[model samples]
Target: PCPQHRERALARQARLTKPPGSLGRLEGVAVELAALQASDRPDLDAVAITVFAADHGVCAEGVSAFPQAVTGQMIANFVTGGAAISVLARHLDARLEVVNLGTVAPPPVSDGVVDETIAPGTDNLAVRPAMSPEQLDAALAAGDRAAARAAEAGARLFVGGEMGIGNTTSASAVACALLGKPARSLTGPGTGLDRYGVGRKVAVIERALRRHADPRDPLQALASVGGFEIAALAGAFIGAAARGLVVLVDGFIVTVAALAAVRLRPELRPWLVFSHQSAEPGHVRLLQTLEAEPLLCLDLRLGEGSGAALAVPLLRQACALHNEMATFEDAGVQDRS
Candidate 1:
């Protein structure tokens, strides 16, 4: 359906009195958005960044080098306008919102932070389910509500980021489940883990997989090892797409959540623009599965929407070119090619 609309947009672009292909990828991106919105004149009014914070039980397995407290600390950093996402959001001139999906420790009082915790922390997946079905539903509802609020605030674009220690482990497990791959194939050194730390992370994931490998229920698999913030991010993807908002996907962990959203609703794929390919091993596999080509490849592995936030300027430039570029006929330039 998008391709059909895109075809019409391309025809319109060609007849705009311009030499074909003068605008390069900007033309293509604009045409794609025109198809997505079914409008020849597409606009990106405002950008919103949602950072979902949660704590993973797998951190108890020594899978991440960072302490679980770091999740809450980073939330504070986000509120205080000191984190990478804070600076990136400022650079993009986008509004930032933080959601306390679930953190191990009590969050500090801060402006622009929404308290929507599903639980204090997930159960250790090495031994039990990370969250119950009710908790997952609540997390998804929280995301939906947040997206509604952002949409009401006139945000046309959204970026999904995460702030949870050991979340990479949860992301890896979700990727393994979705791709039907071994944990070793998807595992990477998260948060600057050493060789032994990497091994420990892989082993923990493998053990969790062995403990719960049934493929009949994807959500069940997620609940067995995924984090609340991850489920909420997945929900945000669904909510954004359902509301016809453009979604900018971040790095590996966010991609896993996007994959989960795709699994839940295949139609949501068209609204997504992947931001970057991360150094995380599972990221490539997930991107390939989604048939997504990222806009950047800076070897970035940090979460917090650092890559998506960085790519917003480029997207804005694309929009500018689409709306403002001069046609060859208007400029009196001959199309010799």
Candidate 2:
């Protein structure tokens, strides 16, 4: 993020044929985009979206509504180009990938899906760490590989998404530990969990947080309670920012990973563009924790980078307006005294 570029973008925006700041936060987005690209003109021409699919051992706690089989099934759907993200990527003409971080069933391998299983799934976090030190490192490395592939292909913007049953429980526990809050404060329904399931999920998160004793170290907290996909998502965010690519963070589980990444590297915060606000209750607090104002708030809770993909077109519009709109002088408009 170059200060000179940001200043130039602001100056250019003020001279456009519109009231100063009339475009609201969108105008700020354009300026930030310019700063990140280190150019007065910035565009999101190349976009890549990665979906990390894994399963959580905490489903044994009866926390999620859907069965664990759904994780692998959804991965297969992604590979077959049948999932929501698949359609969105094709519609937007963005490169989409599905990374097999870990799943109980085989991931139905395909070109767009990578094979990097750390394990069949994580260990039951209720009784043990979700991933061992070695497995955690492997998952993070797998995520790095995904990000590198995207950047190497000339992707200017990156999206990190997640797919895992019972992952909300893992994300909630991680948030509670990172923020020193209770599960009751952060837990929400995941995968259409009913009220009873939500209650059980909260209880499971509380126990895990207690067992970990509210770990202050982000890695310890992540390894203590985070799911494999969650860890991978965090790694992808760090990798994207290191590669100087913008990251559009997705819904609840993915945002939790983004929070972990920011905790690991505070400088990475500027590279993130929160895609949307999730319908999940705890998302608002998480957004506040990051001080992020998302691009949309349509109550979307579907993960798998769906929200981020939808916001890509809006970013294109912002850039187009910033670059193509006529200046006040060109439009023959009078400036207010």
Candidate 3:
């Protein structure tokens, strides 16, 4: 974040033809984005959205309501512009990239998807480590490459999405480990699981937590309980921040990824703009932990960066108001005498 740009934006906001703080959070949003983009007037015209798709081995634990094959199927849906994020991306005219980290059942035609599969999928995290050190590194690298692509495409904002069956369970486990909270506290009915299924998911996460002792290490926790898409989202966020792009974090799974990335590099926190509060039980806690105030909260649990995509308009509007709105002097308005 640039202090100079922030100061300039603040000064300009004070001169706008409105009462001080009249625009509420939008005023702050514009200033913060100005700081993040190192510009007195920042815009989200070039937004890059990358949806990382993978299969989670924990699906074997019967965690999700959907089949593991849905992960791959959704990847196809993303390219075909059938998914929610796909439609949002087109609506916003943002650049959307889909990455295939790994899946047991892959799409028949992956023409638009970036292939970065570390394996068929991670090992069942309940019984074994989800990813080896090498695989984790590969996933992080894949995310970094995606970020590089976004930067090359002149993206000012980066939105990361994930598609992986059983990923909510994996994300819950990772969040539990990172936050030192109980699995039951973070676990939720992913993909519309019933109460019993939620309880079962909690039990599975508890087992994985017990197996992976010393959850203090972020990298270790991710390797033990994280999904490929989760790790990749973390990496892409860090990568995006390094290149001076504002990151709009998505739902629960993506929030966990943001947590992991912030733990790895605390400096990256300022660059992150949480998009919304997810319907997932753990998401509120995660937001509390991060001290994040999202732009919206419409009970969104579907990932694929849909929430972030939705928030883009807010950021754009904020910038528009900041840059185009008349100042007191320009509008010939009376000052508060």
Query: For each candidate, what TM-score against the reference?
Result: 0.95, 0.97, 0.99
Flag regions of model 2 displaced more than 4 Å: 108-111
lDDT of each: 0.84, 0.88, 0.94
Per-residue alpha-carbon lDDT of candidate 2 for residues 1-337, written as tens digits (9 for 90 to 100): 9999999999999999998999987899999999998877798988999999998899899988788888988998997888999999998889988898888877555466788888888988888888887888888888888899999999989988789988899999999889999888998887688898888888888778778754877899889998888888889889999999999998888999999889988999999998899999999999999999999999898899999999999898888889999999999999887
Model 3: CA > 4 A from native: none
lDDT of 1: 0.84
User: What RMSD does each model have against the real structure?
Assistant: 1.8, 1.2, 0.7
Task: Give me candidate 1's TM-score against the actual structure.
Answer: 0.95
User: Candidate 1 vs candidate 2: which has greater TM-score?
Assistant: 2
Question: After best superposition, candidate 1 residue 255: deviation in angstroms?
Answer: 0.3
- Model 2, residue 120: displacement in angstroms? 0.4
**Candidate order, TM-score descending:** 3, 2, 1
Q: Which residues of candidate 1, in runs, are more than 4 Å off?
A: 1-5, 12-19, 22-24
The better candidate by TM-score, 1 or 3, is: 3
Clashing residue pairs for model 3: none
**Best TM-score goes to which candidate?**
3
* Shift in Å, residue 192, candidate 3: 0.4
| Clashing residue pairs in candidate 2 (N, C-alpha, C atoms within 3 angstroms) | none
lDDT of 1 by residue, 1-337 (tens): 2677788777766755566787676677788777776665666659989999989888888888888888888899998989999998887778899999878877665566899977788988888888898998988888887778778788878898998999999888888877779988899987789889888988888888777757425587678888888889889989988887889999999998998888988899989989899988778888999999888999998999898998888787777666666656777776656
